[model samples]
Target: MLQLLRKIAFPFSLIYLLIITVRNYFYDIGVFKSKTPNTPTICIGNLSVGGTGKTPMIEYVIRLLETRKLAMLSRGYKRKSVGFQLGNEESTVLDLGDEPYQIQQKFPTKSIAVDANRLNGIAQLEQLIKPAVILLDDAFQHRKVNPHLSILLTSYACLYPRDWYLPTGNLRDSKREARRAQLIIVTKCPTNLSEEDKVAITRQIKPKIHQKVLFTSLDYAEKFKDDLGQTVDDILFQDKQIAVVTGIASPEPFIQHLAALNLNFEHLEFSDHHHFTATELKRINGFDVVITTEKDFVRLNGKVDSLYYLEVAHKFSEKDKSVLKETLESVF
Candidate 1:
């Protein structure tokens, strides 16, 4: 049924594709100008719509560039406040979007700000503090500010080459736009990705001569944690029944991670960036141990006592990490 609906929407998807293609053409031909910031700026984005492991990839970049003073800028998707809002001591999930707020909480000393306009956000961030490097989260399609280095992410399961435009498929922009990125990372791969798999994907993506492709997988933490910093034993979860609550674009990997542990759980899935209501909170409170993604944890932290979040990070070979580091250093 869903496939049929998507097939019916194919014409509209073509229309969307044409609109995006023309817009990108204007930028390419210099009809639309992209501002180049004085400070080094890096963009972590995806060719598809969402769920390409962007948050963890951004965190990976942050960890890699820990020696330099950095600031993160985002569009603050679904945030309540308007205009350029710099993250401060009082910044909450409502002030910055969930992902930005989560990153701010994790890296308290680093500056984080959000504005729909990337140019304005960068200007404001520079006026406040001159960060050595600025990281732009999910700003691939926002061509107003030209980034010195752009890292494009695509999921192993749903590569952009196999996707279509929005309302019919997952892609928000044309697949050809991926050529703009210098580094293309295939994220959320299985732990044991074979060489044959790499060759196949590389052929499908057909990256430009200057583009480099790297593969990475998600490494879940050994244990879960609660609001009060209490750790939950992984052994205790063996054969135990728990509830999995997630409000992210893709939760299959997370669900499969928990299932691999031989734990039984009922998944209570919600739309991406879903804001929990009072009634939903009451229902979630009934669960004994509710496991959620780190992004969702920010919104559900104080809502339930039994709620715990599973931490995830990017897992890549040291050689690949070195390649990424070298590429960024070249821009600096």
Candidate 2:
């Protein structure tokens, strides 16, 4: 029935595409204005709605810029508080959203700022800390502030180059958005991905003559305990049947990472940024342990004990590290 409805609505979807296409045309033809920043800007974003691994990739860049003066910026999606603010000190899931807070917590020294206005946010951040490179999180569609280098992220399962516009499918905008990015990466790849698969996917994008393509996989960090505080493999993940939980854009990678650990568990998937209630907790009465992603843990304001979260850290290889650093340095 759902499939039938979608097929019936296909003509309406085409109308949406036509509307989007006209809007994009104006911007492309320069009838509409585009904004750019004074400082060096590198945006880590996806063309589609979600699940392109932007957070993990942002974290990767943060670690790389440890030695340099860097300030991380974002629109702070779903943040209760408006206007620009420091992403580290004033940040909370309530104020700055989960993604910015997590970034602040992980990279203590790196300057962080969050605001809806990308232009104003960058200006405020530049006034405070003169950074070498500013990473704008989830700014793929934000064409106003033209980034020095735009990184287009595509999930291993969902490639945006072949995807259609939204209300019809998962894309927030047109696939032409890929043309704006200087770099493209196929993220959340399996550890044992073949060279053939990589070549085939890269062919779809056609390389744009000078654009660089890369592949990245998730690297799970050590086991963490309740509320993402204690690091403990002894209690939560060891010697018990577990119920894994997560409210994220993409839960497949999280599930896959857990499966690789060879742990005995039952999976419980939730909507992105789901707020759990006491009744929902009570429903999973039989599970011995409750594990969730750190992103999901941020939304849980309700009281619950014995629930642990495995904090995964994204680690890029030495070669990948050098490639990123060298490429970024050239632009900055």
Candidate 3:
């Protein structure tokens, strides 16, 4: 039935494509002006609507550029506060959004801010920190502020070339727009992806001479931790029946990780960045051992006692890692 509905929505996807094409045309032809800040800026985003491993990639970049004083800007999707707001110790998930709030929590000293207008947000962050380099999270579609470096992410399971427009497919923008990115990353790949698979995927993407393509897999943390900085005992999960709770774009990769570990769990999935109600919290509390993603853990913290989150990081070959670092360093 869902497949039939998507087939019916195929015409709407064409309409969406036309509208997006026209918008890109205006930007390309200089009918729409894009702002370029004096400070070096890097954009990490995807062509699809969600589940591209963008947050983990952003964290990877942050770790790589640890020496530089950094600031991050995001649109703060579904946030309660409006306009340009800077993150601080007092900032909550409602103020900075879940992803940005999670970044702030991870890097307390760094500057994190959110605004729907990329231009305004960059300006505000500049005035506040004058950061060495500004990282723009999920800003591929935001053409107003042109970034010095744009890194595009596509999931290994659903590459952009095989995707269509929104409402019917995962893509929110045209696949052709991928040409704008200087670097393209295939995220959430299997650890044992063969060279033949790489060649085939690369042939499908057909990246330009100026673009570099890379593949990476998710590296799950060895153990779970709580808000109190206490680690959970791995022995407890041994032959244990756990509840897997997630409020993110895609939970398949996380589920697969747990399954590989031979763990027993029932999934309770929700929409991306879902705000839990009091009743829902009570129900979640009933679970014996609840596991979730790091992003979801921030919101669910202090709400459920048995709750634990799995941490994930990006893993790539040393050569590709070097290429990413060198490319960013060259820009600055």
TM-scores for every candidate against the unseen true structure: 0.97, 0.90, 0.97
Q: List the residue pairs that clash in candidate 3.
A: none
Sequence-dependent TM-score of model 2 = 0.90
Against the reference, the lDDT scores of all candidates come to 0.91, 0.77, 0.91
Model 3 C-alpha lDDT per residue in residues 182-224, reported as the tens digit of each score: 9999999999999899999999999999999999999999888
Across 1-332, the per-residue lDDT of candidate 1 in tens digits comes to 98899999999999999999999999999999999999999999987779999988888899888888899999999999999999999998999999999999888989999999999999998889899999999999999989999999999999999988977999998898899899999999999999899999999999999999999999999988888768787776566567899999999999999888877889999999999999998888887778899999999988876778889999998888899999988768
- Candidate 3 at 69: error in angstroms? 1.1
Candidate 2 C-alpha lDDT tens digits along 128-177: 88788789999877777888988888888888777766655677777776
Global fold similarity of model 1 (TM-score): 0.97
Task: Determine the backbone clash count of candidate 3.
Answer: 0
Cα deviation of 2 in candidate 1 (Å)?
3.2
Collision count for each candidate, in order: 0, 1, 0
Candidate 3 wrongly placed segments (more than 4 Å): 238-241
